[model samples]
Target: MTADLDQGSRTPLVSVLIPAFNHEGFVERCLDSVLEDPYPAKEIVIIDDGSTDHTAERIAQWVAAHGSEIPVEFVRRENRGIAATLNELAARSHGEFLRIGASDDYLLPGGLQAQVGYLLSHRNKGAVIGDSIVIDGEGNRLHDSGMCDLHGADKRLYDSSDGIRRAVIGHWAIGGPVTLLRKSVLETVARWTEGLRIDDWDMFLRLAARDAIGFIDVTVCAYRLHGANFSKTRHTATRIVNLTESREVAMSRVCLFDEPYRTLLRAQAQFIAAKIAFLQRRHTRVALHLATYASLLLLSKLRLHRTAHVHAEGA
Candidate 1:
């Protein structure tokens, strides 16, 4: 376990912070993946966030069997939302780097090493997001690169902080469970906001504003696709609440930008509101939001294109 694999230096310990929910059938696989990872310097922190099912029991069972493999800290508590649970997990961790794991997902071979390496070399980056191998609930290979299916994300956008900001504002996909964050950077961004069912997008927006996030194309985790996945919620009311929350998060970041980017963020929020309106069958409101959204979106795109063209010519 070297700091730089190429240099055979010290390996920085990674705190794997996993906040679990009702994932009884899958939590063991998640723990197994963390254990299977070859990176030697590690600290595992798993919290079963008030799961109604036997998720906490399953986690307990796994810990009892394998806790001695490394430094493991397990906690089972009343259900708080994901964001609060994540914050608590980070607080309990002591690693230089942190990998936020989902109890329903598992990591890939060499994934942690690659992510750590990237952050070490790019000190300006707060976190590095890697790709995920998409799989079904049964562990059947659904395909590869879950981000592609989930976000249709452009790999190149990850190359520049500006591009990532654009992608986030433009509602482009930035996918995965393989994001490894520097503990300091997390502190820089003030940690995750509590009470939000959706957290990653908000956190990434803040990180990108500080030019702290980057993307790696390597597959780092097995992202299980089950019906219960938050993004795939079947209930209408739950979906609306999530959408409303996400829209608020996007809107909250609009003040951090200028010109086209500010407009882009607003447009994205407006687009989300349009979807919410459609869901509520508010046809007139939906039509109005859609028209405004389309115009703002198109205007931002044209301005952004012009800016990029000038930059490319070194103007």
Candidate 2:
């Protein structure tokens, strides 16, 4: 066990990584929340993902005005999307801990400080995620509380194969710019997947497989569920495509090869597919749930055969 140190000495150097797209309207509010964090050594890193609006201009102005008082760094990159932007920010950050915040989302007051305190107190943990308030586009709080995974609540730090298996099987370790992760764990795992839409889920499963994760019961962040959000604008099919692809990437690394694990994943994938189908109004496809589960059972019976066939077919 790692020895706990003094609060002054043990205050983990936290870098608040804010990846901004076309969030000109709410960027200031987001930054304000970060600035309000009571943590003394917090550093704010904002990466503008090629915003076509005045986002860059606004950040520049804020920097000029209060840059000296706050430890903030601003970078502008070509519109490479959120995954690439986050990876770039992680690459350049020097903090011992990283709390990724979306420009559309803001850390509730005391959010950063509280998370840092928890993570430092429990040294073996790799990440700490908490509930978040769901708000409308105008920052009006729609819901005071968020979701959690009852399965993961008992574990102080998640490691080992079984722990990872439970996490991957549709356990709701709610993520979306509402969690704090250790920079060292991220460095070891590398950056986010560039081609995936739900990169947070992928990253979480991978990290939890290797280390411990803590859950804070209180909501410490705000998740903006606006109409203009990426998930809302994109077609359901496109989102599902990304989700399916990302799930494959994660499963491949962890349990895609094992029989029981692969069955579990296929079942969960089918469940997600059904949910997306329902959301897309494809009622016919929603009935595919039973078929998907049946197919999984049949495939599991011939697991080795199917695995060989897939590999041989080069699919």
Candidate 3:
């Protein structure tokens, strides 16, 4: 009983860093969800990134109402992008464990405590992430596992560290909000890469290279799938830019990997190019890029299989 009580008392502080944009109607729920989490030691650090709507106003109201209840550091700032806002929030946070989440999304009950505990026990992991429940704009349950429904990934792939790392360039099933990271690891990666709308991809790619990421088979967040969600926009130009940025980010990290993995990353870049070409109605370019992408991926797979077979025989 004494040891259990001591462990409970020693629960590390988790900084729930939220970057708020124009999520006026949803910011309060996001704040409330943090409070709802059963974690004993936690703080809220939120920055409104130049929201044109009443998001800042809602944040102000929530802080006013709940300031005395918890440690809250709230700021209303000019319109910088998400990456910039996340960097500022990370700098402001002073917690042993950090969770950077979207203001439009909410953390589930006990999620903070569970993730923190997982990291405490798993010394090999610098960051721990879990699945998220995908919900509609009206808060209706769309899918229990965002990894499966939204990310189009095999959920079981997240069961192992190697699986998650391989998926970094292949599937990208990790959710940004559900990840609980150590301050040291975030600092090691130098935090979010600014000047890119597709920022998290670059950061995670860096994390994967360092083998600093882990996963838990739990649903810890509500990933709201509203029309305005970053990856859901129908605007053709925005899609093109996002795809291009993704390719650039992947290409930048190829130096960290060797032969097969490097080829896989390059193949992913080519796949993204094919997507962009299709969007631009350059069917010929799409065909060419797709062919090269497929060929590179197949070669990588064959080499990987051969290596695995040799290792098995050696063993």
C-alpha RMSD values across all candidates: 2.6, 7.3, 2.9
Model 3's lDDT to the true fold?
A: 0.85
User: How well is each residue in 82-168 modelled by candidate 1, as lDDT tens digits?
Assistant: 889999999999999999899999999899988888888887888888888888889999878676776687767767777888877
Q: Lowest lDDT 10-mer window, candidate 3? A: 1-10
Candidate 3, position 228, lDDT: 86
Cα lDDT tens digits for candidate 3, 20-125: 9999989999999998887778899999988999999999999999999899999887888988888888889889889978898999987787788778877677
Candidate 1 residues lying further than 4 Å off, grouped into runs, are 1-4, 230-232, 305-315
> TM-score of every model?
0.92, 0.78, 0.93
Candidate 2 vs candidate 3: the TM-score winner is 3
Best by TM-score: 3
Which window of 10 residues has the lowest lDDT sum in candidate 2? 149-158
TM-score of 3: 0.93
